[model samples]
Target: MTHLDDTESDDIGTLLGADGPFARELPNFAPRLAQQAMARAVQQAIAGRDTLIAEAGTGTGKTFAYLVPALLSGERVIISTGTKTLQDQLYFRDLPKVRSVLGARLKTALLKGRANYLCLYRLDQTVREGATFERTQAAQLATIRAWSARTRRGDRMELAEVPEESPLWPRVTSTPENCLGVECPFFEDCHVVKARREALEADVVVVNHHLLFADLALKQEGFGEILPGAAAFILDEAHQIPELAGQFFSQSISARQLTDMAKDVLTECTGITGAIGLLLEPVEALQDALRKLRLALEPLPTRGAFQLLEDRADVRASLHELRELLATLEELLASQAERSRGFANLRERAELFTERLERIVESHGDQDVRWYETFPRGFALYATPLDLAVPMRGLRERTHAAWIHTSATLSVAGNFDHFARQLGLDDPRTLSLGSPFDYARQGLCYLPPDLPDPNARDYTEQVIESVLPVLHASNGRAFLLFTSHRALRRAAELLQDKVPWPLFVQGTAPRPRLLEEFRASGHGVLLGAASFWEGVDVVGEALSVVVIDKLPFAAPDDPVLMARLAALEQSGINPFMGWQVPSAVIALKQGAGRLIRDVHDRGVLVLCDPRLTSKGYGRLFLASLPPMPRTRALADVQVFFANALSPDARDGGEGRAGV
Candidate 1:
């Protein structure tokens, strides 16, 4: 066992006081297994020679477990979360409570991406440009203007009622691509800069994974360090890190950004005379040509693999034409005109695009990665991911203090190979803590007998039929987890009339509101995909059944997924074992975890996927879950739910019996 050093012991001893901000006595609260795990993590972090991968189970009070060690150690720590919601939770709620309780008046700050903070220069520019605003947007701007006058923090979350998707958000926000940085007239008043300055001074900093990865990508280039060289770094929700890192490591130039750059330039250069316009005409012509090329590619069938510019000669010819156009644009930019900014921006875009295109053309059939992605609305584009493992390694190295990475399902059974390999870490100190809940006594994993294949057309109907009786037995308290949104919608429609519970679809009332209603209504059944998996905490009888429609496989047709699979195959790895199976196992563990959140929580889990029963690979997935009582009979599930939903049920009172 690792002993707390003098500094750690002193900090903890001081905090366990009668007059401290702690609402409860620390010793009275039973010590948790997570505390031991966290203690070891702190030791490892202080040593700064090894990495740690810890899978602290639910009910571990995992947040406070790591926070205590981090605070007591007195190190500059950076905490990166998977979602903005968690970031807000940590910054606004968790940190303050911990500080007050611990009697540690340590400075702390919350920093988010530039997009989350209002860019005063951009806001002023948008208002001055007389940009047309929709009625709702105009009202939002008026509200923001009023709030901006009184607000001190300038954090967007301070605004009481801002919708996440408000058009006003982007109008007031800035991106790295569009930001003029220190050169801006409003640089001193910049919210992003102010937040960063606060973070630099703070002992602890909270940020989301996206911003953390962005800073890593930009670190050598000297933009800004979101996750600075900290004494300790704790990455909560570490499961999502790989995919997010993939995005950060990839190069993407969006159409919207390109168009925005052009518009900004046009606005900046509007009052310039004729010679500049004539010279800049070629820049516009080149943009139009590139736009037409993208338009042509849009209608093609959605297929795997990046589309390289066919024929090196054709690509070279286009490059020559673009070069000539940019040369003219440079000449216009050199002229002392009001539109110089526009010309300069055009020139920048040309140079950037040419470089990206050259890389794409040269990377075909090479180890260098290239791929295409299309939006739901049908706009298609290309990307090239830089070496991912490098930034991942960089993050692990920079976080100097204790780093504890936890998730509900960080391993496949007991092996951490899949998750470890993805994070580019090899067998760092690893631990897997089992859930305190006794799944063998309280819950049952039910797989219906003789079900049709999950990929068949009639699978949705079969799944709904299989779970309706259990839903009826439990009187609603169920979540129908689907592999896809389409399946979720279909099952929701079919089960609407058949089940006794009032159904809540995922998108109907927003996630938090729907969950609130589910708890309030009591007889509530929710059907959702993806987001329904984890971070859902419904204890007691309110959630007594979890019906997973099928194995949650990453969509095979997703262009990025396909590309990754191809790359894996070329490396002589089984895509299923190395990629697809592990991903599904993690997701399934998330869904299954929702059922038995607390000790008193008892539920029936119905996995409708036949593959779990028929294939040898299924054992790996099963071993990843809680040690639940397994059942194949629908009758057994009905009985289990009946007992779970009853008020008189007594096996797991106060949520500790399951343990």
Candidate 2:
């Protein structure tokens, strides 16, 4: 048996030497600050005493840093991430290399959420239902079905070119609402179960924030936990945890549930014998009541939990009406010609909706925090908080393990308190690792001295004017990140006709396609919203300038932000300092992070929001960026760009100190 203990005293540098497997396996690999962080992190994990929040800067080689320690510690570890791309990256690319180099002494597993795995039973049901499948999707389904026959690894990411919103995806995936679990026909061969079993057996389990938060929520109700008793729980991309945790912590039921019930009634209205319409009478009544509920809530903010009908009389009356009607429908369907045929679907849907509504009504009031969601040209719902902090704290307390939460933008102005307070972590060991890149020589921070206030009319026009020059200097190898989609659209309109380069906007093509076109078309200037702020990798000269329209503060009118800030204010906290500013700081960092992804990458981060140089709060945003050459003068920016592209760009004459 492989001994489960601390790694033998060995220099990590030696392990990373020229003759070592790491050298042979990864050509561009070398010792990183992350390696040292990992050694300390591993020792802390073993000690099991305190939480560690270590910031491994961009290109600090953080993934391998944590992975090496997690592997060498010889204990069960669960690594969670914010994105599926990184999750798959760790599982498929990084994990294998680590195992091979370490002589395969450790076992690891990649576990995705249920939605990513195909539910054989559901797939079969969908096929039986004769749902006319799209041609390409049908082909992909056939491929997945064939591959499912012999494959042991059940990751959906293995299937290439499967767009996230493919219609076939929903038909094949599982949700807790529809999952029959062990009672399903294909339960024995369930991909989710198989993956979970592997996870339970492995020394390390890789998961994303959604899955981890789900497991935490599940444990509250005595549902199964995903990660076993592990020595450490390392949450990467920890910046995203709070928002996701808020979601898992909240409860929601949508008007769509009632709509689906009405559709079910319609489906069962025909082809059945006795009293089909009568049986569906209560369902129809329930649908009408739900419509009334939606109308009653029409006056409220489009999103957030609010009590539209105070005193529970209207809602209780509706529930009573629904319950009585459902009973009649059940009795009518019981006497139908085909007893079980054509009846089960509607019955199941009705029963589920009723149960969810009952839960909502029963849990309403201040005891359970309540809210309503309004979507623009989309579905809306009413929701309540399902105790977010409890589960999160449970995960923290039970693990009794040294947990490390790291991100490039974790702290705002050298203070980790904002995220720490939200996550219920107190004074965790923290460090701010400056980016290792030579930012002074490679990058410029351009804050336009004169611009209209970000909130004023013609703000976007001014932003475009300020940034268009930088784009010209770089010949349009730029990413323009806007605070809102409306502004993005406005800026795109302003630049489309005037700019002397190919401009790609976010919604014009899908995000990946836009990024592709931007990278390929050398005159690349891509304008995008939130998705473009972070996780966009455009190394080298292909992305030479990132123009941010403004400091990316959460919209004051956003329901969640308003609600959260209100809650903070009620508790006697400065909402701006406690919530808004820190959030914006993190977001600004994400936008600025796009500027220099590699050592060879040289660029300017031009903020059209003069707040970075004008406002007192600007210092917070400024301090959060890489230690780069800052500039405000138009002349300085022009000179810097000229020097950057000149033959002597690398020779580095001190262009301008602080602009």
Clash count (model 1, backbone only): 8
- For model 1, what is the C-alpha lDDT against the true structure? 0.71
lDDT of 2 by residue, 1-659 (tens): 12224454245444654565677777677655545545555455455555877666687767776777677777888899888888988888988887887776887888878888877876676666665667897787788788667666656766766777776776678766556656567889888888888888889999888888777755421125556587788889899888888777666667665565456455546555544546555666767766665555556566554454444566446546655665565555445524544455445555555565566556645435555565542344445353345556776887677787877778887778888877888667776666677787888888887898888999998888888777777778899999899999888888878888888888877777888888888778889899889878887667888888888888766555666677778889989987888999988888889888866777888888877778888888888888887778877777776766453553363232222
Global Cα lDDT for candidate 2:
0.72
- What's the CA error at residue 254 for candidate 1, in Å? 1.9
Which lDDT values do the candidates have, in the order given?
Answer: 0.71, 0.72
Candidate 1 wrongly placed segments (more than 4 Å): 1-23, 26-30, 220-226, 271-291, 308-350, 376-380, 384-387, 394-403, 508-510, 645-659
| Residue pairs whose backbone atoms clash in candidate 2 | 302-374, 303-374, 304-372, 305-371, 305-372, 306-371, 306-372, 631-659, 632-659
- The candidate maximizing TM-score is 1
Structural similarity to truth (TM-score) of each candidate:
0.87, 0.87
lDDT of 1 by residue, 1-659 (tens): 24457775544433333343342644434345454555556455544545677787776666776676677667788888888889999888777767766778798888888788888887787778776778888888888888877777677878857777676788788876566666678889888888888888888888888888788665522226545567767788998887888877766545455456555556665566664366456547757755654554455455445544343345345545544654555455555333454344455555665565455545554444565544533333456453356666766666554556776678888888888887778557787776665668877888888789988998899888877777777778888888898998898889877766688999987788899998888778999899988877788777888998888888877666776777788889988788899998988988988987765677788888889979998998898888888889878876665544235444344332331
RMSD of each: 4.2, 4.9
